[model samples]
Target: MTTENPVHLTPELVENPVGAYAGLRTRPGLGHVVLPGLNAPVRLVTRHEDVKAALAEPRLVRDRSTIPDSEMPDPQAELMAQGADGLPPEYAQYLSGHLALFDGDEHTRRRNPLTRAFTARRVAALRPFVEKTARELIEALAEREQADLLGEFAYPLSTAVICALLGVDAADQDKVCGWIRDFAYGDGSRVLEGLGGVVQYTKDLVTRRRAEPADDLVSALLADGGMADDEIVTVFFLLINTGITPPALFLAHAVLALLDHPDQLERLRAEPELLGRAVPELLRYVTLVRMGATLYATEDFVFAGTGLRKGEAVTVALFAADHDPAAYDAPERLDVAREFGRGDGHLAFGHGPHYCIGAALGRLVTGVVFEELLVRRPAAPELAVDRADVRFGHWPGDGFHLLSLPVRL
Candidate 1:
């Protein structure tokens, strides 16, 4: 067993947390624990079974209206999946349109267009561009003998793809990237502080897109996304700022998992097709974005033999649910070869009507990027970097961090 006290908080877990989690899972489930020194009653759902049941059960909600914003909801699950502590009006408005934050048919509507645009076929069409981009980036890194994959490659790659989908200019890419960075790297306070700048940028872009329409989603939205400037500004704010935040962090986590599992890496290279199935598993393995938006129970519901309070906070313990052994056999094991054959499912992208809309986009990016990494740099050098050096935003369940790898060329 690891010697580090579970009560002690460290940046290491925020970077590569599988070990810490494995230890945590072994502890007794019914104990009430404080987050470091915080005075909040938190129920840690470490076992695979408990996490799974909690996620599927409707009694566990996400909306902040159900829980007091100032009070942290069990620090064990950090990084507010909804909108951090305290839902500000502008931020709330921004989140209302983002498909991940919304529920019901409304989310379906905003998602439909993008969904159609990113079918398996569409993602396949993107392979060539992805390969080309990855190849060039790797070549540059190999030449330099070192690279910050998160900042240098992953961030630009994902952001560029999102922009292309929205019809934003490459010139606007850096400015747009700033919002996601602040959200990903900055704490809860910084997120609110940086919101105004992101909103202004999105609003300006919308104004331009409205006056001079283009063949992008923004134009289509102006013509069809079914929202005016005010509404468009809100969605745009979420798209750049909020939506990109968690994903950026999690993608880094997935990459770290691959780096740690060399055998799995080789297996992936042998059969690239496994990527489709493996993406979900990888999402589960890291449980990086520990939870989804805290949902508020609209009506009375009973689950797991527990009576839930109405308007009580219902949260999908995403990390818990994804890692739950009930859904995955030997949940802790990173088995790339496991067929999983078939099963219930994972909470990586959430569940029910509120499922993640950008899920396809994220999977597409991660999978394609993985394939490209193998193809571009087939050298397969082992990473030589300390876990502590790879730090991330200090939040419970935070993912990724400063991953600086020194591998043999």
Candidate 2:
């Protein structure tokens, strides 16, 4: 049953999401939660079974355009998704071909080309570049007595990987990152402007790649010719926006978690072969995206025994699902050698059709970075400040990330 009061996403909840969501997950039905920046409350599905099923439910669509305005809970609330309320008409085109925001055939059309784009060979090819980038960043970090790993190493490394994959010029990569930062985590005022800048820059990059074809993602997509210019721009836009943040956040958090659990750290270093298992466990333990993308109900239906009306927004709590005791034994505990067979893996990268297309690359990036940091370096980095001084950057639905993970090398 729905609670009498909606759960406000307060600082306490965001700071300790696992504990907060644990209390909600045991409730009989979905919880109505007010996420920051949204005008209305969204139904939060927390159980692993419900979240997994909800993700693949055909009735729940990601694209708001599929359902008419009349069906909405409130027409004005439509724009509130990802802070899009006052977006100008011209800026709308930049959002086209965003695979995560589409549904059914449209999603398939947009995603199929990208699926081919991230082929096994393509991801495998990226490993060397990932390794090289991580090595350089780590070396740079070693020179300093203390370093903010998030800024000094994680963001730069992830940004470089995405930039290299997208054929972005080294000079322009920093600017692109700034635009993304403003667009994603900035205050309300610069959202549209930041988005415009990123899309326009991608458009320019795509145009250049069109003229001078290179061995890059843009060139590869251009070669496919399945998507239009605007679609390609948005696709790259999505990739850059998503590519940099998640893996970077994962890297920073994984380091903090390992430092907190030295036993696990030693276990990982001792049995490097367990890195594969440790990666997923770390992902589950340190959730990057606390809430999955908002999904709108296409029609009235009973979900997890609760009636969900048409146009109601539902968010799968990825953090909660990955930590659900039903799915994972001692869900709160971090195990480096956690054995997860197929169909039972953690939902950290998500599940079903909308599963993150960059899963392999993300895994590759995280693995390579850890290998370089833990195995090659072999020195356990200590927190520069007191444990209490460590702070996390939290955005409404994006979850907590390290603003600056200060570490003494």
Candidate 3:
């Protein structure tokens, strides 16, 4: 229950979390870990079964506001209760109102409108745009001798697509997305500053959209009139920021993963239709989100044979769960045709009500990226730098936050 023998996050752990968690996964009950972003040590859930269950457990809640003040843990809960860490007031104001931080009816109210945009038909309709954008980017990359795939292709394509959806001006897309990129993936010191810019930009964009409605998500949300101005601003901010990072990072990592496993890449290339399977497999293999959003226990309960106290924070090791040997035979191997396209059981997008809202978009963009880069191309791009030379950003709670993946076309 306590972190007396807590696993401290280290460079080694971030570099290879699956291997680091393997020992803990085989043991009974949950392990304890001191992750960087968390205010206190948390109960670490690693097994595939436990993680899947924990994700949907009603007693486990993402909105800390729902927990009673009396049950809140001392300094840990108090510190987190402060909310923004050290974010500027203007920035924190918008940041705090986002739908992801809410629970129950409030969460449902905020999520319902957005769900219309990500439906199967809607996502399918995006294929053409995704493919066209990818083709243009790939063609540009082909012209270059060597380029950082993340910066040149993945980031641009992701930013452009999300901006198009949100009606971000073509001229301002780069500036807006650059701030989000800096906030999400930058070195520690600049995060708050970068986030400040994003909030301010979103605030102005919201004002513009209100004055002159356009045919985009922002205008649509405004037209719905279900959410207040502040709520709409935060939602817009979330869409732009989340929309860009996950897909961009996933695309870069997918390319790297395939390049690393040539046999799997060849398999995918031969069976071009295997993308549906390949996407989830690569997601499971790479595990973009190293940890799921921290959930606080609403009541005292036993989970995974461990006695969890009310208000205790539970963090799921998503990367570990996806690679869990008990769940997947030959879990370490990257098989494009794994499970014959079932695409079930991976905690990459998580499970339950709070599952990633952008799951469909993430899949669509990354699938299109691979389609343009590998299946339809004459040949795949080659890593310009030694595979070992390429590095991921050392951000806690994020897996495979690729800094730059240099490749030659």
Candidate 4:
């Protein structure tokens, strides 16, 4: 298992994730690598089949506390120590009660209600509003020759939609968005400050919703007798935060991918209905939520033909799996019309019980954004800056994130 040079996590690799993933796939099965910030050894599952199997295994657990101190990464250990305790219950849950960190019955109980809230029918109903929002945002850029698509279009559109869903007041949307960005992707030291701002805001929102319920999901969760105040706050925190970053990044990358492959972009423009197939393909190509999902071996077992001790941590490389040569015909090609079969499925949203709950909403928002942008624009938008000049930020536990995307219509 030892090598002269192990893969070291770095911003360079994050900037060009596809290349990094391709290299990792060359390993025997699972490759052992050290994450930079955490500075700890983790079993990196790269191949599509191996990543899928690991995700489906019931013996792997999400809770990091179960792992022995000797096995846990220092950063992870520090994070776990900060879990809900002295803080108010609502704030505690907001910090540590996300669905990604739960397992078994508790995970099931929390997820079911949220699942019902984001049904296909419900997401479809949001299409008109999403389209309207996209149109408005795009039209606002009419007076300018060039704009930062990420800030003016993607961020606002996502924030508006998620705020609408969570019953967040229009006046407070900017503040909430700021806090979420800092919490998820900002400086490490300021993360706690960002978390505090979000928790306090969510707690206040929950109280207001409880006193006077609305048609929004937050109100619905609060009214549910089975859910406690802290649980409701936690749900709100997860939904609001997750709702923004992934979709925003997806939009930015989708636009970048489409522009890079003009032939595919032309095909999409010629036949707009292909959005159904195109969105999934784009998701597969851009696997924005690259890392974050980790599983601990509940007991001693062999994974990917390698023996693993109990309580060892495994990080599933969704980006690597999505681009696995064994899974797709031309894994590196960005073909919007590429067809996917059951076994050759993409793991962009993950697999098994922990798959993204907001998958439908994400698709709707992204589809509507592209439909509106491509259909209504006088001409296709072009990158104002050279593609090579574009910059991205790499959050260690999270994935590569686009900081700014400048374009001209």
Estimate the overall C-alpha local distance difference test score of candidate 1.
Answer: 0.58
Worst 10 residues of 2 by lDDT: 70-79
Once model 4 is optimally superposed onto the true structure by TM-score, how far is the C-alpha of residue 175 displaced, in angstroms? Answer: 5.6
lDDT of each: 0.58, 0.80, 0.77, 0.76
Alpha-carbon shift of residue 209 in model 3 (angstroms) = 4.2
* Model 2 CA lDDT for position 136: 81
Cα error, candidate 2, residue 231 (Å): 1.2
Q: Candidates 2 and 3: which is better by lDDT? A: 2
Alpha-carbon shift of residue 394 in model 3 (angstroms)? 1.0
Clashing pairs in 4: none
Instruction: Encode model 1's per-residue lDDT on 156-245: one tens digit a residue.
Output: 676666666666677877776666556544434566656776677777778888899876667767766556577766656555653455
C-alpha RMSD of candidate 4: 3.3
- Runs of candidate 2 exceeding 4 Å displacement: 1-4, 14-18, 37-39, 69-89, 169-200
Worst 10 residues of 1 by lDDT: 1-10
Better of 2 and 3 by TM-score: 2
Q: Judge candidate 2 at residue 241 and give its lDDT.
A: 68
Q: What is the C-alpha RMSD of each candidate to the true structure, in Å?
A: 5.6, 2.8, 3.0, 3.3
The sequence of per-residue lDDT tens digits that candidate 4 reaches over residues 1-409 is: 4423557766556435467777777767566666655566678888888888888898888876655654544334544554332555545646578899888898888888787666677677778878888888888886698888887788778877887787788799888877876765455556667778877888899889888987777777766565677787788678766887678878998898898999998888888888888888999888887764677887889888877778777888787788788888887898888877663257888898998888878878878887888755657788999998877776565556788889986
